[model samples]
Target chain A: MIMKQFRFEPLAQASYLIGCPRAKEAVIIDPIDDLGAETYVLEAADLGLTITGVFETHVHADYISCARELAEMNDVPHYLHESATDLVQYSFTPFKDGQVFEVGGVRIKTLHTPGHTPEHTSFLVTDTARTDEPWCVLTGDALFVGDVGRPDLLLGDQALDVMDEATRAETLYRSVKDRLFALPDHVEVYPCHYGGSTCGGVNMSGKAASTIAFEKRFNLAMRKDTPEAFAAFVKETAKPFPDDYARIKSYNLGLISKDAITEAAV
Target chain B: MKPTEVQDAVAKGAVVLDMRPPKPFAKEHVPGAVNFQFNRADLAERAEMSLPQDLTYIVHAEPDPIAKVAIGILSKAGFSVDGYLEGGLKQWKADGLPTEALPLLTVDELKDGLDRYHVVDTRESFEFRFGHVPGSTCLEWTEPWDQMEGLESEKPLALVCGDQVRSAYVASVMQRAKMDAALVFGGMVDWLERGYPVEKSPKKAKAPRI
Candidate 1:
């Protein structure tokens, strides 16, 4: 298994490229932009690996996600949770809660982890060739080091008439406490966003990944077992909402095409 | 030379570089001049950071040859040199021109008295996060009403930036706002050059606590 994490310091975003150099196949998770081509793709080509899958851990609120753009350019299967179809206008294969994808010797299972957002999903990865045991979990915004994702960022966006910050917080609490924590402590956990960032502006960890056991012991959010306590922590730790997050969502949904800006014909 | 010309140039946003050692500079010098040793090691590296590339620079140093050399150093590195003070500080003094100085603090003094003063970084949030004074707050640049919130008008502020250029501007803004804020002399360049500890915010430094 060849796993590399790429972090954009300015945006506090992290993307991953997990490859099977043995099978010459790979996949990317939570990509930020087309800059991946210059970085991970070049690295993949050098390793003689073909990318078979791409994923958006969730519809990003800070910067635009390039999952669709990279998928189109590379002609790979892009996947996202089915729940995001109404909020994001991108075409992708939807992986349900319990679906699993096997690429090369790796088994990537989808855990419909929602809380950071309704469509957020996490992947439990196992190197099947080595053993039946799982290796890691890509937690996305559902969980972070030192803190879990801030669920209150959804406030004031009326597009989701059924969802609000409090409701999101409730869902997030359930997702982290019930769904993600259900995994074994030995499983290595990799999540996007890390320290030195705002509550909403999560960055990547220094080590790139931490053990589920370590996070369970060290993360402040994990200590609070009740959903109410977790939601309160999310509210208290929140920063001023990220600037221009709504408009960036429009770009991700393909509603604001670059062609429209250059006045090019559709 | 007319004093008004120097004032006009300064008013138009030229950085005044004083190339005298700290001892001489402290007694008397240009009102907002930043001091860097005239001939010292790492002067080039310091200049690249502490000095702004955009604005013109007016150098004040000793004798004609040395002053020209100082200007040459900056000019070689793509800095805009508007030229040196024709007669230098001694001549300016002889002409009964205005000169002033403030009580200077070494990094040691600032660290010892850290609690007595406030540290404000004028760098953008990203730059500050890369590394900064642990307890300092950020006020990148300010709007008319910006000071009302982020700034503590009561506390003495020591303003710093990537280079002194932005902080120098911020110092003036603080003055107009009636806030007591001084440039951190050489800014981040000097701080890093001195090898003081820099801190990263946990929000951005999100390593697992365990």
Candidate 2:
């Protein structure tokens, strides 16, 4: 499997294109704005590959996502957790938590990692050609380089009532410890954001990727602590909310379609 | 010049004349300094309104080129332009001279004042639409200078913009026009970081309306 990581410097976001050479098939994770999608597609075409799936872990607040547009343009499936169906405005294939699928020889498993948002999911992909153990987990907003997603964004009476600020923080803790950490220490962790992002505070080392063991030891959000302490810590340092959050959320809820977005040059 | 020389001059009753634009002077300038605009055509009239004919004016700008222009203008006007601020206001500040408050709002302060103050964003119309202090009245920076009529000049008008420089200049202009106003100290970024309330202009749908 050949994995290509594209970093959008403005928001410090990372998107990925993972391809299986034997099958000439590929999948993209959390594609950013249309510019990002265009670059990814051009690169894939140059490599003589076809993208079969475009995945979104959650509705992003920092920048607009081009997942819907990329999927529609390429005539490929867009996948997200089933709960995200109501949250996202576009059409997509909804996978239940723990659902498994195979692309070429790679076995891709989806884990419902819901703390960042009600329907957040992370994919653990196993390269059968390399090893039975999963090689790397693509953690979207749920897990970042050093910090977990801020839970307060999902709060308020209108959104998911079950995932209150406190409950979301606790769920995030469990997602990091029980699910992500339960995997082998050697499993590499790839996250969507690094430090300097307004989404979360105090990211780990600002590196694009890390091992499970390294995060367990160094990630302040993942360090062994009481759920209450973790929640309090996150609450105290929660970053100033992004200025574009409400617009992004509404757009994700499908009130706005991809074609509705009018890109402007900054 | 050395710090001691500045101190000695102050001790000898040397006047500290701030030649920066009015907005910055209003935000926080040396307490006793009077404003003198370098670009104003009726500088003699403005000077006659502020300073006595016999006083030796020590002209100072934020830095050199501005100070030179101020000195040249005052000298031409037949006022005794004693000397210039060596490094301008910043250097004077670095030397620990007393400065006064212009009292500009950070984003947090603007948020806190959502219920009380009528914030006025003095940035350009394009920037105002991006984001501004919530409940602020948009007065484009290019708005005619005389349109400031009827508003209570003493009612603590808060001037806000993307940064301090423009607001400072505007404040100085306001002060010269004999109006009372204050500059928002750190500008919009500082205000937003402190979790202040910002109202997006209605024209820009991409930005948030706080």
Candidate 3:
């Protein structure tokens, strides 16, 4: 499998271009809207790959996603969790939990890891030629290097079926403990944001990647032994919500037109 | 042909024509198998240019159709062909046949054994201008496999890019061309994050010392 990470310094956001070079095909995950669709298209071409799909881990609140634009531009499917189909305005291919797809020698399995937001997903990638075990996981916003995504973003929001902060925090804990922590110790963890990003709780690492073992050993969120404890940690560390999140989320959900997203809004 | 039959045919001096992409072929394949990727447009031409027509060959490819396509192309190229392996390498492995793998080096392993490798930085010159492995040769990942320079050495080539993705692809193709190349998983990002020594000035790919 071929994978490249593109980092947006200002927002501390990261997007990935993962491909199977032999198959000459690739996919973009969590593309930033301001990055422009052509950036990925040209980048993939330079690597001798064609963009075949686009995926969003969740309806992001911090920034808009270019998943729709990239998918439409490439004439490929835009994938989101089945639970998000009704919540968003645009059309997409709704994938269920544990759904697996192949791009040549690379196999990507979707794990429904909802916590930060209800429809969040993570991609577990395997290079079948090398090993049946997953080589790395794209943890979207669920699990970061030293911190996990904050679950309080949707608290009191107008988005569909909003949950309270405590309940969402508990769900995130379970998702991390049961779904993410279950992976092998050596599996590399690549999250969407890192240090200086508003998405994760305080203590997020400046490092871009970490092994599951390292994260398990040092991550503050993972140290919490119980869901209640984890919820309390989240509440204790919650920072003031960014004022532009609602506008960003609305644009991402396609609730508003592209024109509605002014330069000042982002 | 069934997996067991492929083994029998192999014993009778039939060559296994692996029709998968270079990466899978590099990672694992039948012992003594020759890879001619099914996706290559010049599969028949490349095979005809290199392979002996008198020898019988068996196709090993996945999804069944890929194997069939290779077989058809070989037959048209006037090569004597045996039937394809029933379930490709997956079935071959299931039947307990032996396979081989190329090296996939982690950043730490590459650092520890730097002397044993001809470190090839596959990142672009612009990216390489910032920082790269000390004494590494800069050969952009997009450089055609045959056109790549500074790789002919007693030491195995260790391929690196900003991340492992580009180097992995280059290493796959390099292995397919029968070069002694190992992919540096996580590449320069991992190397830099680990605080390894780096050369800020870019170096051009030069012919290897005799």
Best by lDDT: 3
lDDT of 1 by residue, A161-243 (tens): 24777788888878877878788889988888766445342322455578888887877776777878878876776667665
TM-score of chain B of each: 0.55, 0.53, 0.56
Q: What is the TM-score of chain B in candidate 2?
A: 0.53
TM-score of chain A of 1: 0.90
> Measured against the native two-chain assembly using Cα atoms, what DockQ does each of the candidate structures obtain, in the order listed?
0.01, 0.01, 0.03
Scored by DockQ, the top model is: 3
Candidates 1 and 3, the one with greater TM-score = 3
**Model 2 chain A weakest 10-residue run by lDDT:** A257-266
Compose the digit string of candidate 2's lDDT tens values, residues B99-154.
Answer: 76555555565566655565667677888888877667766554444443224432
TM-score for candidate 1:
0.53
The digit string of per-residue lDDT tens for model 1 on B37-149 reads: 45434446657755556778788764344456677778887888787776667667776778875444555666677787777787777887888876777666432323423
Query: What is the number of backbone collisions in each predicted candidate, taken in the order shown?
Result: 16, 17, 0
Any runs in candidate 1 off by more than 4 Å, and if so which?
Answer: A199-207, A258-266, B1-210
TM-score of chain A taken by itself, candidate 2: 0.92
Candidate 3 lDDT over A1-266, as tens digits, reads 89999998888899999998556688999999778776776666456465778998999999778889888766689999999987899899999999998987899999999989889999999999799989999999999999999988873555564667777788888888889999999999999999988898788988989988898899997799988888888778766775688777888888887778676565
Q: Candidates sorted by lDDT, descending order?
A: 3, 2, 1
Candidate 2 ranges with C-alpha deviation above 4 Å: A155-157, A160-162, A257-266, B1-210
